[model samples]
Target chain A: MAKGGVAAERRRPHSHLREATVGYAFILPALVGIVALYLFPLIKTAYLSFTKTGVFGDSTFIGGANYANLVTDPTFGTALRSSAIYTVIVLLAIPISIVIAALIAQVRHGATLYRIAYFLPVVTLPVAVGMVWRFIYNGDFGLLNALLSLIGIDGKAWVADPTVAIFAVSAVGIWTSLGTAIIILGAGLQGIPQDLYEAASLDGAGPLRQFRSITLPLLTPSIFFVSVLSVIGSLQMFDLIYVMIGRNNPALSQSQTIVYLFYQKAFVEGNRGYGAAIAIALLLIIMALTAIQFRLQKRWVFYG
Target chain B: MGNTQPRHHQIIIHAVLGIGAVIMVAPFIWQILTTFKTVTESRAVPPTILPAVWSIAAYERFFTSVPLWSLLGMSLGVLVVRVGGQLVLCSLAAYGFARFRFPGRGLLFGVFLVMLMAPSQLFLISQFDLMKSLHLLDTLPAIAIPGMFSAFGTFLMRQAFIAIPKEFEEAARLDGANSWQLFWRILLPMTGPTLAALGVLTSLYSWNDLLWPLIVASNKHMTLPVGLSLLQGQYGTDYPTLMAGSLIASLPLIIVFVILQRQFFAGIASSGLKG
Candidate 1:
């Protein structure tokens, strides 16, 4: 109860250490937790990536050998390419989210219905969503094919065909993520005041004109946020690929994301060294892209 | 009046929303529909929209095949631990950062911000090794451990604590309340909404968490989603059974969402805004 200890321990100069002790004690658990789980692991993985690891988890440092192997690894190329394609496709959801969020923000009626309908996918188990979508994308006797037949078009093996597999899985990825993007954008939309629109309309501006000026400019921050999140999320895409295109599938090679490839090498093949290398590779790509986005944001991301 | 134009615009809005909603809702509707259909009907060339005979056969198979009760219990057990850990650890760390002026405060928090930025994949291999060393592999606790360390949750709660009016703490200090008392009684109680928000978000995440649990837990220790994934692998073509399993896996949260719709939406909105 040292009342005067506020503002950097003005009470007693000796009590600063005591005050800091209390602070350290308070943060000790979380600090220890992250140090153990996140920070230490990050360092350990980096160390392990350079080693030639054995199945027994023992390792000998081999200095860039794993990275060398990663360079030559053909599957790495496919994984990186698939990950990039998925991120690009999923980024489309932000524009889609903007329109939907704008519409939802405007309408007073059935807002709850629209929100809940979209949010269902967000809450559902990805494994389940992946399973159901795989069935729907089945070559024969699938709901998608059946619907296509109604429109007099035939459907191919969506998750099984190597050429179509990544796109098919990307579609599912986009579908599940729509709710999250919309929720963020919806909140962002709400922060844009109603009076701006009313004033714009009073000035005889069309709804589109008001949106182009007032809505879009103000919504840039949310759009940027969603894009960063989407890029990160899409790059880590694994659950749908694992569920929809199983480990044994011929299409697995074409559709696997970086995380999936990491899982394969680290877990399945017991090549922890290679997996660590892949993980580090993904981290570099993500850091580079996120940095670029942040750099680019000044040009477009409006604060007000 | 522009009222006529507004009414006309409303029709197109509803139509677009309605169409999108159908696309959004169809897979789930189909999952529910196909759950009741016989194998014959589910695999029919032109798929039937609704089941000719409504049946719980899929449910029966899913129940009888998987160790449903154990996995569900494991899911809940892990959920409670993970959520509890977030509330306690994040609150403590946030309180410390918000209220204190320690020597390494900024640097330590910078460490946390770095952790938050890196993807979960970066830590997986080493975390797996750590689990092995600790002999926690294939255990429900392993599924719960890495999740407990949440840089994101800490940052969120810290921001919440910072946003609290400083008057409460000053008043509490005047009453000779110590730091712990100030934290538990005066500060923590006021952060109820943020606490609830963190709890809800963490619960959703932990409940639906797949990859970590999928990696660590092999059998009886598998959480709900991991178990559901295995069920899919085993019953690949059995849409009915898979749908039933998937529905069961997702049911608890869906029910919670339906009941606490406002809070969940509020939680999502705030998490989106702050997060």
Candidate 2:
């Protein structure tokens, strides 16, 4: 059909407009869908965040009340702290992942096996990862506790204890994300010109010195990329806590992430207005943090 | 700088890599082994590497107890629709930006980028509200409609399409191929790797997604992840049975990653670098 159209267009000069119109026609479905579904909802959400509304379609204009409630809400504060802690702890995994990636790249044998092993957690469904980790973190018959007993160290109920619960969930965050970071960094490592390393070797540079002066600087782009993404992603943690911690768990208070709070308020509590406010606040925080990273990248993120 | 030093360095690298590999694989090994074990043996001290009573009880129970096959069918159906729609729509949008001049193109593309960066939660509440108003709630369309068009896919396909040399299109033009013919017959064939990569990514995301499905689909149209989570509520302490069910749910994604590791990395790496 397309070939037939081309042959017809060749005989007439007036069909160029028709051809260009077809190009626009091809994109119309997606454009219309995005506008109606995404853009309409986005603006409506912002409006609803500012207004007071109930489930019964009663909406009243209330300026700044929801945002005010967000500022003073105790749950919001706890969730913010949890989100910050989760972001920092999960970000620590990125550097750890880089070191592992560098090591894996140097191995000549069984690289494929190692790659598959490391990437298993990332490729698996998050619900599965959450459930598996929940089993491992169980207090009495959990594998971690059993292993700890063999070494004469008693393990606590990891995901149930308030003090350790956030860290427990963050561990899964790190574990699942390590594969992605490693793959990106490994690719960057491969792209580095080998001649530079050879030149450094001729200059009597040791392995540590070569890595410090060459690999670290050259890998900055991927490092920066992973850092920004990890931070943003960790700040929005919800699924693991939702599945692993359960709703009525004692440690739920300590490990409630911002998105989880949004879920509780919006769905569980039926405070759609308040939930929209928290979601907006989170969006602002993310946008600000990302903007700062972009601004700071001029100073440190080396493209080469 | 003799052969001895190089050998020593090689030894250090292997030792480091070997330890890292064990840590990465330990959890999966534990999960797989426990699935085959009986209830008591799985929880035993100094955990057994092999199940004492190797039986198909857990696997058999999983297939019999849960609506596992129906959930698998639901997930595959949604994945095919969503991925197919995304590929067709995103490629057309990409083509508009890549090959032709159009009005409001820059602003439209800017909206696409902003949609990419916007926190997914912000869109959820209103999207749900919209679905409710439209009477599409609790249906598969609620899940499929919102996800069918992705901004990230559009941006990625645009970059890939733009990277193709203009001479190919110009030569086609001289040969009397119009825009539709050029795109469909010539350009589309050349985008095999990018399209394959996008297909895999879209399917994986839609398959593994939990949140949106949890919000929209309740009983009839529940997806794999949502169904699996609900199953956890029903079967809490039975680790072996739970592991078997999860293993079944995750099998498709593992097969995908194994087959397309390179293309997956290329697609993800390109997007990450640009971001």
Candidate 3:
């Protein structure tokens, strides 16, 4: 590129070449860092998944063994199920946030106050959020139990129960994500035409009818975007579970997401090759899901 | 547009928003209340919303035990340095892409866009290796250096700059203003909202960041998030202390959001939609 730019400048003697060369020079550092650090590792992960590396460095060729094991691994099956559940649950919350955004958009009084309250969790550091929420879920004196006790309800160890742990974690995911979803949905709602509502009313459509006919169709693009992002993010869920549920937590074995399993194999266990396989598998899942969403968007997402 | 139906709709609107507000504010209220309670008080059978005896014991203990001040300093230090560098460099690159007709421009900017799609997890190992090789393993710069350039910021800024009327830049060019002067005098001033949104977003990310700082800063440069995590470990099962630390760590973000709430949403929506 530098050669091409310099060569073109010599022939044409144009100011555009000088300007472009300078632009490239300024962007060079970030480009170099990203290529070396991000893209290289991504490619390397893909390559390493194909080979058999005993340690992080020592290597041998054993094509498809790790991936074949990944196919039948019971843990992988469980993790996949858990990841799917988390994604579905989190995706469900998007509509709830959209409804909330719609309601907030209609109200003139203290709308910013509602936004701030919701966004507080979004802005809080994930580590801190994890810690605080972990304490709230504690079995004995945890706030959830205490709150339940008020109504004579027994709140078991929410995050320790295998049946409920993933859901518990999903609840936090829903909470933290509410702010971004609300803000995005609110922006989408504002893009909707005011005349649509007025016209619907003149035609004798009720409020709910107006929203169903007017708002829902127009908001589909943002809704689709939020769903796509939520799925991608939920599949990669790790930080909160890692922090809230201890490494030794019994629920960890039952509720592990694929990315959490990948972190375990790659970072903690130092089975870098197997971990790389899991990472690559997870990448394939993301790519497939994203491709499908883009394909399906034609059926649903409205541009306006 | 008549008053009756519009007024009736207003009642439903408030009721709905009111419920949403309660749900959103509940957990934070719980967190704040827990911070003030004693370990025993927090664990009481009928969980107390407000402490029976109000005390600063938890807050006092957190400050004394953890290097809360140093962690705060680290968060601020990384935020100030990285945000300053990123604002300058990202805006420059954004303007270059938006205005200048340069050779290989499409290919160069394509790299930035591609990098935007790549998640931070992909770079964890290589970035660690880079920092280790540079002998910056346990330093603040390890975190700040990677954060100094953001693809999203550059992409958003370029869009903002492109939205500026080309005639403004052309007028500056007609007056013999150089490229730098055009960017500084004409372009920068015109994109105030974009810059505000970028600044707030960048600062918030840097301030609340955990993953990279966790990987990069060994012990010496422990930021607030990392420090708070360690606090959770050390004070095993101590809710009050953890709550207090979490509260303190959250204060900066809350203050920043309150002051710049409008810009934060604007920035997030624009960047999310575009990127």
Candidate 4:
């Protein structure tokens, strides 16, 4: 890298160097961000996972102690279980979104209305979503209970009961994500050429028949994509749980997602080493899932 | 176009979709209704469809209880720096990667991709530590810094930049336009959609971000979401006030989204497609 303008450098020396310098200058700001946020932390998290911190806030190399401790830690276990449950449950969004996207695609009128309605929750702040849902789940005066009362069915404290809390949170998770999946799948639906359906129709294929033959196979890529992203996003779920099932809630223990546990251990409990270990474990799980997804994509995701 | 569904089928589709749409926006509708209800009416067992007395009592309580003004200010502050920084820096980097044949370009861009794929949790603990060491804990910048640039934005801008024909760059260069001038005046202007999409996405993310600000900032530097979360925690059973606060915090983004629905949808589509 040189320190002159292109004209000056052409008349002088190191013109190639000056060009490289300018190129580097252009990327320097973003490079600083990647390093500061990603690269540095990645290596640090890996290292800290293997260490323990003293009372003085200094870390000692106690290899695998944090990892071994996590194996027996009950809260970690609960968080892991809840997170897995959430991931599995939210995967339902894929099929739901597909149906909605298909339905929206067929409509010639009021399509944007449906899109806006479905997508509104996705844009609303999660804290707000959590709060409103919490209020809706109130045992005595909640909306859910009120709605159930009309049918003579009883509704329990949806977010208050330990047994039902994670499911409650999972519902919100699925709700927030439907909009993104619908948008993506809707785009995928549009990309399925109109003539494919028209051609199928000329061949006497009914709507259901045409859908199975033309729409399903072509939209598999988006389906596969939305599922993978949904799972990844679901595993990292925090805000809704944090707001809806706060510390004082009886269901907090049962509803703790892995990331919630990570925040608690690292910051609230001052167990950075264990928290780092949990984070690494989550990273590994995500990688394994992605690998599994790619392997499975071959079976269904039509690249064409 | 040849196949409009049968009449009965269209009726059924609309019926199902209509119900689903209602379910989707039900909470928001409730939030708005609850915001204006009296405390007693808001909690009615049968639930009043509308408040017998539409009131701003909850708003008064919320404004008095929470630092709504400052929270909004901090969130806006974070959003501005984050979105502005990402657009400028990401486009510059993307432009460089698009145009330059520098050594390590492949390696560095690969690194950016890795960062792009790595989720936020991987970086949280360390980012917090970095902020601590710099004595920046509980600062607005602490909330805003990590998101000031993003791998997603860079990659998106890079793709947009690469799609620009090479002849334009050669033409600009023949005019003796420097790299800055080329990016600022010529090439940058051409990337309007990409820039707009990234800006909208960045602002939305920054505004709704909870975990980072929840961890990093306390009362003084608290962003809107974090503040709202705390409001929920402290005012646990106060549905009216909570809904009121939530509506106020969410209104700005909702308004912006309504105005820039195209950009919002485009931004969301790009992100999901990139996956």
Q: Would you list the clashing residue pairs of candidate 1? A: none
lDDT of each: 0.87, 0.83, 0.81, 0.88
Best by lDDT: 4
Flag clash pairs in model 2.
none
Candidate 3: deviation at residue B164, Å? 1.8
- Model 2, residue B161: displacement in angstroms? 1.3
In candidate 1, stretches whose alpha carbon ends up further than 4 angstroms from where it belongs are A1-10, B1-5, B273-275
State every prediction's TM-score relative to the real structure. 0.96, 0.94, 0.92, 0.95
Better of 1 and 2 by lDDT: 1
Measured over the true interface residues after superposition, the C-alpha RMSD of each candidate is 2.2, 2.8, 2.5, 1.8
Candidate 3 lDDT tens digits, B185-271: 888988989888888888878987776787788487799988887787788777888888888899888888998898999877766
Prediction-by-prediction clash tally = 0, 0, 0, 0
Q: Which 10-residue span in candidate 1 chain B carries the lowest summed lDDT?
A: B1-10
Question: Would you give me the overall lDDT of model 4?
Answer: 0.88
Q: Give a tens-digit lDDT track for model 2, residues B5-66.
A: 46677788778777877887777778888899998887777677799888778888788878
**Candidate 2 chain B, which ten residues in sequence have the lowest lDDT sum?**
B266-275
The residue ranges of model 3 lying beyond 4 angstroms of the native Cα positions read A1-13, A51-56, A59-62, A149-152, B1-8, B273-275
RMSD of 1: 2.5
Ranked candidates (lDDT, high to low)? 4, 1, 2, 3
Candidate 4 wrong stretches, greater than 4 Å = A1-16, A54-56, B1-8, B273-275
